[model samples]
Target chain A: MNAVFQVNNLNKSFGGLTVANGISLSMEQGDRVALIGPNGAGKTTFINLVTGHMPPDSGSVALRGADITRLGPTARVRKGLVRSFQVTRLFSDMTPAEHVALAVLQRTGRSGRVFGNFGAMPDVMAEVSEGLKALGIDHIANHKVSEIAYGQQRLLEIALALALKPNVLLLDEPAAGVPQSDTSRIEEALAGLPDDLAVLMIDHDMDLVFRFARRVVVLAAGTIIFDGTPQDVAKDARVREAYLGNYANARSSV
Target chain B: MAIQRAIAAEGKVDAGPNWLLRDLMGLAAVLAVAGIGYLLFPNNLALLTRITAIALLVLSLDLVTGYCGIATLGHAALFGSGAYAAGIAAVHFDITDPFAMAAVGAVGGAAAGLLAGAIMLRGRGLAQLVLSIAIVYLFHETANKASNWTGGSDGLAGISPDPVFGIFGFDLWGRTAYVFGIAILAVVFVLLRLLVRSPFGMLCRGIREDPVRVSAMGASVNGTLLRMYAISGAVAGLGGALNAISTQVVGLDSLSFTTSAEALVMLVVGGTGSLFGALVGTLTFMWFEDFVSAINPFHWLTIIGALLIAVVLFAPNGLYGTATQLLHRVWNKR
Candidate 1:
């Protein structure tokens, strides 16, 4: 499998506490990888470093074999490496349609045009509606984002990332604040992504992780403990001791 | 590459609907008011013309502060710079053609905008606001110190503009000047209307909503804002040049702190983001001031202060913004 995205020996720290300690990973096109770790394991930091939200202390991130380590977040997004937030970051006053439409406009490179009503652009509108429909929130397209339920907001978060048409998509946490009943909708929407798109999801819910991820990577104390098939990750002695055992109990209660 | 190609191809298509129609209605309202003023108070045309120029200043302020969410109290620097540039061109360079003077004003204002934007955009919120105010003071002092060029604190004098298109002389009754000011205001209003409704305008709105999200969307938020600032400067400059031409004098009051504060007040009173609000706010404020001062010059400011307080309490969105919202609500219900 050709690695569409590669992270090599990334290191980052805040004060004396190391958040990412020489982490290295790669994802092939069409790969579905779940990164699971205990709290403060630096999962979000690692994602931030890769997506250009923060500069890694040492390491390189490459997309399609081109080095993107020094690029800013927006430049990286334009290179087709996109990320959704841990907590949904959205324009509170805008509608889902407007949010997706803006993304579509950015994708099409028409965001800088000083003339033309964006809502009237048929191609952009088509892509925006399609993105909303993909996330099962087309019915609420015209409703203001702040007026929507938290679950719908979370789904809209994914919808935003999808509209960017990223070659490598990083989801910080797709189901963090979503209700239990709405998890299925997120899962279903995630399930519908195209086969060739690479995705890396950082999630704490092991049941969802094990369900969605074909391969699971376990992180503990800012280091990778295991990387293998989901079943092997579930059974790994070190992973069980470091993280998964506690998750197993939490999953049963939930 | 594909994105670049799409932008190259699709960038020039007509932005849906007639955004100009909205601006046209606004211009029509201004012209109608001007016409009524001509009939009812023929002697007060000069005051009405001055209001037109100040309305342009307020409109320009709305672009940066209202639409782009740049907190500023230094916009007077741009206006004053424009006025001085036009006055200097007329007196020293003998380029008295009104259009030429306005162009000179636009260039001067754009330069000031570039300088101010470079310095002010480095910070956000209070830092930005304070820096903007400082820049205005710096420009004001610079103009004051250059006694020979700017006529110092005595104000620039000995300037006269050639007949607009070499025909319409700026008459004492201000018939020509009044029409000229309205004409410039109308053209600028139309252009700004198109600008604010366009895709670029949408990007600015997004930046105002959340700059981080806009940046994450692969946009250069600061760069876009800088461009908006320059455009806004040109508009304000045009207003200042119109003032210089009509009055044939440039004053230190143009660069004073009060001008900046008053322009901002007019913008907030009109509402921030909407162009029509800018016009409505300027006209209402100036006319109300004129009427009140005539009635009780000593206590006119108190009345003005009370009116501003009432606006804040009752029309939280400013008069025009609240009106637009109400109209939209009614239209949606129907």
Candidate 2:
């Protein structure tokens, strides 16, 4: 099977510290891959390198077999490789509808329209409403992003990434700061996403990782130590010692 | 059942183009002010005309600093470039047609904007602020040194623009200039109102809030901001051209730092983000200056400073922004 995304020999270093060390990975279409690791395992840096947020020291990234390593973040996004932020980067003064509408407008190549009222643009508004509804934030579409709860903003973060119509999505901790009670909503939103889209979610919540991901990749000391099915990840000794030991023991104790 | 009902209701409720109504009202208010100015200050039409020209400058400044969130104190560089361009075109080229001169001024201003935006965007926050100030000083010195073309410190003279469409001469009564200024202001205002409500405007607003997020959404933030600066320069150039045509001269003061600083103060006083706020701030500040200086001549600046401080404290969004918020609250209650 052809891979939709391929990373070959990516290397990134800050000073002498290697954040991404000769890492290589690949994802097929419709893959639900969870990247889990202990803190400072270079998961975020790897995501950054893949998404073109920063230039990797050495490596090449390919989307659909076309080289995209040198492309900027915006260019990568236009090529259908979109990412959500660990911290929701939303306009505080604008409403959720405006944020979603902006993404939809950019997706349709109409964000440059300077004459008509964007609110009056039918396609943009429809997408905005639909995107918001999908994230369960439709009721607060008119409210400013600042007025929404932190959990809602986190969901809006996912909603914005989805609005770009990404073929491959990189979600950087979608439920990072969300209260436990509110995480189910994020899960529901993720669960409802299209089946054909590839998603790589980096979340510290193991429950979310295990429940949502069919395949798991474990990063340890800037390298992938484990890559297999979620069931196999639980059984793998390296994954337990490196990252999943706490979750495995907790499950047994419970 | 409740969810279904809400969804059905949402479908029926159109967010419709409410801005069209706001635009019409804003135009009416502007025209009404012009009419009032004609009646009350027939003798002071020059000052009123000057206010109109400065209003355009402040409005243009709002586009870059307010909408695009590009901090600039060298905006007067664009204005000065336009003014000098129109003055030179009228003097050396004998291009006396007001419209043609305005067009020349616009081109000059846009060129200055493009150059300045490229240089200034390399820095952020404090560095950007310093760069903008440096650019303004550079423009000022260039205008001063190039005495032959720009008339140097002595100022450019002999700008004799023809009548409006060959029908009305720019008479001593200032009727033609006043009417011309108001008409141009109205057209520009309407265009800008439409622009700020458009997708491009929303993108600028997004850039203002967070450039990183805007880029992540597939926009080139620097390119968008550069385009915004050029458009702003064009608008300011039109204003500068109007100044040359109406005043019949261009002075070094056009490129001065004071002009840039005053424009920023006016924008802050009016409310930075809203076009109406720019106009309101210009009117309030200029009128206050004209009226108070006429009365107190020496201590007027102290009064103006006090007023600015009061505005910052009491009406944080400037006069129009604060007033609208108050009105909205009252209307909601009703």
Candidate 3:
């Protein structure tokens, strides 16, 4: 399989503390991958650096074999690498449909249009439908994002990235805010995604990480401890020690 | 496509009127009302004319402070520059045409916006506020020191704007001035209405709401903000030019911190995020200022300060914002 995304010798430091240290990984097209780590293991920071939310101290990220180290998030998104926020990053005032419509608008290569009469735009409704349907949110397209339930809002954020019609989707801790019962719902949505969309998700939930991801990459102390199949990662002594260490207390509280 | 209808069944249109038409109809209504108002009270026509000019000024402020979310207190500098440019052109260069005054106004405002935008881009929030205050004081002192051209502390006069379009000569009551001001205001409102609702406007709001996200989106969010500042300046400058032409005088008051503060209060009172809010705020404030002054001498400053504080604390959204929310609540109740 051809590699869709490649990260090389990534390192980032915030003040005196190192966040991502010499991290190297790759994602194959159609690969369902989980980036698992204990809290503060630099999973989110690594994702942020790849998506250009923050820059790596020294490293390179490539999408479709082309370098995107200096590209901004939107430009990176345009080139088919998009990531969702850990906390829902949505236009709260805007409806679910409007949120999707704006994403669709960006994908259309339209110039920045903060002030046009977008009401008359012909494809707006269609774009909203495509996005909402992807996440089974067609029923709440017109609802204000703020008015939606917490689980639904999380779904809406995923729908927003899906609306971008992205080739590669990066979901940062999708299951973080979801309740136990609703987690199954999120799992179902992840399971139902077509093979065409390659999703690189970061999760603290070991079950979803193991169940959904065909491949799992484990990080501990800002370094990749293991990158292999779920069974292989589960068997790895290093990953087990990282989680079975002080994380035993951390894991039980959740 | 059918899925969209299904989605629509879930939620209704939550926004107010469609943007472009709302502005056109709103401004047209303002002009019509002003015409009727000035016609009825010919004596107060001059004050009403000044109010219309203030409405325009507030509209410009809304662009910078409200929409773009840029805190600007030095806009008074741009307004003062426009007033000075128009006054000098008329008093010294023998160019008294209203059109010439408008051109000079636009250029003066654009220049301030460009200079200020370039510098302010490096500084946000309190830094911007400090820089803006400095600019205001700098211009005020410059105008105060330039005695010959600006008339120094006295202010430059002899504006003598020849009856707009060379028709219906300038009367003592300033009827012709009010009409011309209202007409130009109509045009400005329409142009601005279109510009603000455009994609560029949305981008501005996107940046205003979350600059970090905007920067990530591959757009130079700061660059876009800088452009917005320039546009705000040009529009505000034109508004000041109108004041100079209608009054036939340019005062150093244009550069005062009081002028900047008043503009802010007007924006908040009128509802900052929109054009009509600016109009309504200015009109209401002018009425209160003029009429209240008749009953008590120090009504304008005292009431405006109190009103601003009340609006900020109680209303939060100000007049138009509160009105919109109230309407939404009512609609939901029904």
Of candidates 3 and 1, the better by DockQ: 3
Go through the candidates in order and give each one's C-alpha lDDT: 0.86, 0.89, 0.79
TM-scores of all models? 0.93, 0.95, 0.90
| Model 1 vs. true fold: TM | 0.93
Fraction of true contacts reproduced, model 3? 0.49
Q: Write the per-residue lDDT of candidate 3 for residues A139-163, one digit (tens) a residue.
A: 7777777788888888877777776
- Better candidate number, 1 or 3, judged by lDDT: 1
lDDT of 2 by residue, B1-334 (tens): 3443353355322244355777899999999999999999999999998899899899999999889998888889999999999999999999988889989998989998999899999999999999999999999999999999988999999889999899889888888888888888899999998888788998999999999999999988998888888889888988898898899999999988999999999999999888999999999999999999999999999999999999999999999999999998999799
Better of 2 and 3 by DockQ: 2
lDDT of 2 at A59: 89
> Which candidate leads in TM-score?
2
Mind giving the per-residue lDDT tens digits that candidate 1 earns over B165-197?
799998798888888998899889878888887
Cα error of candidate 1 at position A15, Å: 3.5
* Clashing pairs in model 2, backbone N/Cα/C closer than 3 A: none
Off by over 4 Å in 1: A244-254, B1-15, B18-21, B328-334
Tens-place lDDT digits, model 2, residues A72-146: 899999999999999999999888888888898898898887877655665666777788888889898877888
Chain B global fold similarity (TM-score) for predicted model 1 against the true chain B = 0.93
Q: How many backbone clashes does candidate 3 have?
A: 15
How close to the true structure is residue B328 of candidate 3, measured as C-alpha lDDT? 87
